[model samples]
Target: MSTIKARALVLEEPGTQPVLAEVDVLDPGPGEVRIKIAASGVCGTDGHAIEGTHPLARWPIVLGHEGAGVVESVGEGVTGIGVGDHVVCALAVPCGTCRQCRRGLAEHCNSAARRQAMSGVMADGDSRLRYGGERAYPFFGVGTLAEYSTVRREQVIPIDPALPLDEFCLAGCGVITGYGAVMNVARVRPGDSVVVLGAGGVGANVIQAARAAGASTIVAVDAIPEKLELARTFGATHVVEASADVAKEIAAIEPDGADAVFEVVGKPELLTLCLSLTRVGGACVMVGIPPVGSKITFDAFTLTANRRLLGCRGGAVVPARDIERLVSLYRGGTLNLAGLIGRRIGLDDVFGALDALGKSTFARSVVVF
Candidate 1:
């Protein structure tokens, strides 16, 4: 296959905004597949990358991870996936032989760490994209903000072709991360009471997952009334406007406090607040990605009261398994995949979508090709 020139959203440097530029996309390498990206979501991480706040983001990179597309070509040794297949690109491309993968913690696979160190390039330490003859990195190995992308075979998980690529694209990242935090990390059981902070994209998924788990009381908290209202559509039984008295309100709703509190907002103080909302012996799951090197403080005595604090990466998901399970739920109408999309847009509006994300105005804005 010949090199394909495509318009991509490229971050040229730190402390600068991303721009649309024409770039050369190479053919799939060994064990790689080239995809015609159908849709990609504007996630908070994308905003962070544009602002140079994300620790792992490398400049002169394409910024997008949550996406779905049609496979255009496959390299040698690929199996169970092929050209013409519809697939969701998972950010957690695990190496099955890694220690974390062997222990069933594929989200934290050792290969991911190695790849992250390379700063958005593929495992080969070379970029698949070039602009003006200069190498450009593809964010998280799948830069879906472009017309096409070349990604590792392991990163593309085949899904039902009939599913709407724009909607199902969420299962690749935000949805999976939030839902997995509740189902896999917190492990909220039936009849449990849960609290989800920051009812935006990921928080809404946490609420939905908690409800699916049969949680009797699911409290959603957000400073924005609109977000809290939107949270209810995703199964938040109670909504609270975030304030100094928010914890007291949650305590009143669940007198003994919640069984699990999910902090999906990366605010340092909110981390402590979420832990405060968890009942003694309950779990506090941190699902949000805070700025690198940011720290939080909590009382040591309170932490020793059998309350557990945990950090979840991509909801501890095995993408190959969970993406299929999420798709099944979406197919059954049990998961409200369509409702999570706030708006559909084209690539030209990516900057505006990222602005809306910073303002917390929408749950998710999808860029449809």
Candidate 2:
């Protein structure tokens, strides 16, 4: 295979700052496609990987998974997708043979083959990138931070070329996670009440998705007033400034408590607290990415009422089906993707954006190629 040189943001190790370095990118192999990234959304997961917190994080990895771009090349046996097709790089690629996949729970697919891909290795157990003569893995197997990335066929989802790549890139992760949490995981129905904690990048989408699901009352909770205000634009019917009385505030909005509560803040204590806010038979979905190995306590009585506490990994996203639905919704004016973008920056400004993950923020900072 031929190799080409490209600049990528490489995280050499945990707790170290990522640097832009020119690296070698190998040509796509069988069942692989090379993508020329046009834009990528800077996400909290990237920050977590840089800090060695994400469970599937790997060292010496190229960062950035929420990317949309054009197909640059395709390898042997690759069909239906070819060079020049605009696509979004998907984070979850399920191995169809796995029990989880066959059972239609592809988002939770844990096959060894899928895990290897999640760790940034191809089917051959090798990396497509090399930095300073050493192998470098791609974060989440897509590595959209680079100008070019080679990924498995399932990871590259073709999209409508008319949609703006910068805004659509978010469909790969943040959008899909938030949207799918309500539509796929929690299954919030029309006239239901929803409570979304943390009005950040993904939280905002969760707020909107709840609205799309036709939730009658959407209460967005965040300590930042700016985010609470921004949450309204995305469909939060009411806003609550996070404090000791968050549950009380949510109760005021929904007397019996919300039908569904989403803990987007990823705090363990909050997970337990949010669980308490669900009605007797309501569901509480934890949509945040907690630190790997972090533990949370559940009040045993919380479940006696039939209140459900569920974990959402990437919104239980089934890539092939969900990505297409997202594009359609965006095109139909049903999904507000533009509202999710806070600012657009170049690759040079990624460090500033990456460091802003946990801080008070409402929208996403996308890196446009």
Specify the highest-TM-score model's number: 2
Clashing pairs in model 1?
none
TM, every model: 0.97, 0.98
Q: What lDDT is obtained when candidate 1 is compared to the true structure?
A: 0.86
lDDT of 2 at 126: 90
User: Model 1: residues >4 Å from true position, as ranges?
Assistant: 112-119
Per-residue C-alpha lDDT of model 1 across residues 222-323, encoded as one tens digit per residue: 888889888999898999988749978987899888999998888877888888888999999989888887888988787888999999888988889899
Residues 1-369, candidate 2: write the lDDT tens digits.
478788899999999999999888899999999988999999988988888888777779899999999998899999889989999889887898989888877778979998888889999889888999999999999998999999999898898788899999999999999998999889999999999988998999999888888899999999888898999998998999886498787777788888999988778778887887889899999999888788998778889999988989899988889989887787778899887888899999998998788784657999998
Clash number for each model: 0, 0
- Superposing all C-alpha atoms, what RMSD in Å does each candidate have to the true structure? 1.5, 1.2
Per-residue error at 182 for model 1, in Å? 0.4
